[model samples]
Target: MQAEAQLAKSAILEVALQLAEKSSWDRIHLFDVAREMGVGLADIHRHFRNKDALAEAWFDLADAALLRLAQTPGWQQVPQKQRLQFAYSAWLDALAGHRRLTREMIGYRLQPEHVHLQVRGVLRISDTVQWIREVAMLPAAGWRREGAETVLTTIFLAVFARWLVDESPGTRKTQVLLGRLLVAADLGARLVAGLSLRSPASLRAFN
Candidate 1:
């Protein structure tokens, strides 16, 4: 039963995507998806609350891709800075095939009327950031973890916004931006660590 339900959801999601490619995501209705699957509206409802939920499911795929790529052999051996780079790179790659459609999905969620979805979107981003930290093995805690989350959230949104419209060959532009920002973030983290490590015996004793 569990496998059947999971298969149903995957089928609905895939059918929705196929329809979206033929038409705009906003233009595709639940009826369209149901009809494509030869299932009732209740069937889709069982799998997704609505179209926005389906969009969330799509982003979930990207998160899975990022985690898989991040935890691959030797990922631990890679420099921490590059680990972050790899995370975002893998995520965007999952959406690269449907860049325009993905952009539309995000825009739909951000519409002024969808205040609840907008709020959920923010939480969704934070969840993804947490995954990035876990996969990259970032050791930040307390205030440092909070600060790191803030910095990474900003970088991800900015880079993702660029990717929504980027046409550069192989998304090199987005990758370049991600690398530069990650390196800068790493440098800032190192600087903070150095400053916080003041010797207890020194006059400026701070742990």
Candidate 2:
């Protein structure tokens, strides 16, 4: 029964992606997704409350895949910075086939009228960065933790924006941008560590 439910949800999301590519995410209705999947609107509702929920589910799918990748032996042995670079690369590769739809969805979510979506976007990025921190065995609490999430989220957004227009073969441009961002992140992490060690009271103050 769980498998059947998962299949139904996947079908709805697949149809929604196709619709978003054909039209605009703003114009995509649950009814259209249902019709495309040959299911009742209520069926899609049973899986996702609304378009925003469906969009979030899409991100959740990517998150799940990333977690799986992070668990692989190849990922387990990488340096902290390299682990992040690998994860980000894998994430963008996952969405490569859906680039156009993803780009359009980002634009739609960024509009002033979609303030809620913008908030959700930040939350989603925070969640993903938190997961990366865990997998990389980084600090899990305090100001440093929060600061790392902020930096990683900023890097992700910058890379994502560039990726939308990046035309270099094999996404070399995106990879270069990610590499540079990770380098900066490493420096930031080192600086934060130094501060934390030198002034434990300052760390507590921020926390």
Candidate 3:
């Protein structure tokens, strides 16, 4: 029974992906997914409440793949910035085969009129950043943690935007952009650390 349920869920998601590849997300309804999978509407509803939920599940699938890659040996020893690079690289690699669909979905969600989707996108980025922080074994809470999340989220969106249109082989352009951003981030961190060292009381007050 459990396996059958899982299969039904997977079929729904697979059908949704196929539909998304051919049509705009806004036009692709749960009914369409159900029909494509030859399942009852209730079956899809049993797995995903709505299109957004299904999309979030797809993101979760990608995140799971990224997390697995992050767990490989030697990943833990890398510097935080390098770890982030790896995470973002893995994420893009996972989506490479579905680049067109990804681009369409991202573009649709980010449209000015889609405020809800924009908010969801921010939340999703926040979640991804938190995951990256955990894999990097960073401190749980503090100004540094909050700052890292904000910075990493911004970097991910910026790099991801470049990645969508990037045509260079191996996504070399996106990689270069990420490398530069990381260097800038490192320098900024060093400057902040230096200032904190010079004014411990101020740092404490800010914290």
* Top-scoring candidate (TM-score): 1
Per-residue lDDT tens digits of candidate 1, residues 13-115?
8888888999898899999999877889998999899888899989999999988976588776776667778888888999887788899999898889999
CA lDDT scores, all candidates in order: 0.82, 0.76, 0.75
Give the TM-scores of the predictions, in the order they appear: 0.90, 0.85, 0.83
Which scores higher on TM-score, 2 or 3? Answer: 2
Off by over 4 Å in 1: 195-207
User: What is the TM-score ranking, best to worst?
Assistant: 1, 2, 3
Taking all chains together, the TM-score of candidate 2 against the true structure is 0.85
- The CA root-mean-square deviation of candidate 3, after full C-alpha superposition on the true structure, stands at 4.5
Residue by residue across 1-207, what tens digits does model 3's lDDT show?
999987877778778888878876668889898887787889788889878777777777778877886668887567566776777787788778767777877777877998998898887888887786666555435776677677777788899989999999999999999889887776676576665435543242111
Best by lDDT: 1
Q: Model 2 residue 145 lDDT?
A: 67
**Full-model lDDT, candidate 2:** 0.76
Taking all chains together, the TM-score of candidate 3 against the true structure is 0.83
